[model samples]
Target: MRSMPNTNTRNLHELSADIAAVVRDVVATGEDAVITDDGTEVAVIMSMADYDRLHLYAELADAARPGYAGATEFRAMSISEMLDVLGVHPTVDRGLRG
Candidate 1:
């Protein structure tokens, strides 16, 4: 989320003690929490929306760069087409084809 842990930082023990509270805080704030172990960041807890946005951003950035495998074939396609290149077809994802 940030360069390093901020006020939202929480130790691993805090999670083991009461995960619900930590989760509630994250959802309420809509900001990820950095879960650390002995001052070292181990993981992050974030809302599903944030996680999805992160993945979409990553995919877009990865696809925009040259030599990304499908650049030539999908170069001029719309966003939906680019998604199909990644096998993430929104309209027919997860074998929902009919």
Candidate 2:
């Protein structure tokens, strides 16, 4: 008794020439593009399954971080610091490893 997922539509202009790069996002977001000629809509493209999946993920993300606006700052860390934070053992046996 699985219900069919809802589909979303988008305009052709919204799609990028390098869509393959963002195929995953496009599918998950339930977003797509409608090709148009002159003033008439020609075709529609989208990933119903992907859109539903992405939408659900987005809802979960929002629920997980309630009241969090968004990313504010971007910081770069050194390789040693990143490894330490991740508890990853450095492959290179550098005696001076952090």
Overall lDDT per candidate, in order of appearance: 0.66, 0.47
Best by TM-score: 1
TM-score per prediction, in order, is 0.63, 0.27
As a whole number from 0 to 100, the lDDT of residue 51 in candidate 2 is: 44
lDDT tens digits by residue: candidate 2, 1-98: 11122333334565466456345555655445444545456654556653454456544444445354675654555534544554545443333211
On the 0 to 100 scale, the lDDT of residue 61 in model 2 is: 49
Error of 2 at 65 (Å): 48
Regions of candidate 1 where Cα sits further than 4 Å from its true position: 1-7, 70-98
Worst 10 residues of 2 by lDDT: 1-10
Q: Which pairs of residues clash in candidate 2, taking residues 3 or more apart in a chain or in different chains? A: 27-50, 27-51, 28-50, 28-51, 30-51
Find the 10 residues in a row with the least total lDDT in model 1.
89-98
lDDT by residue for model 1 over 21-87, one digit each (tens)?
8888778766578889988888888878757864785577576667887555544555445556565
Candidate 2 similarity to native, TM-score: 0.27
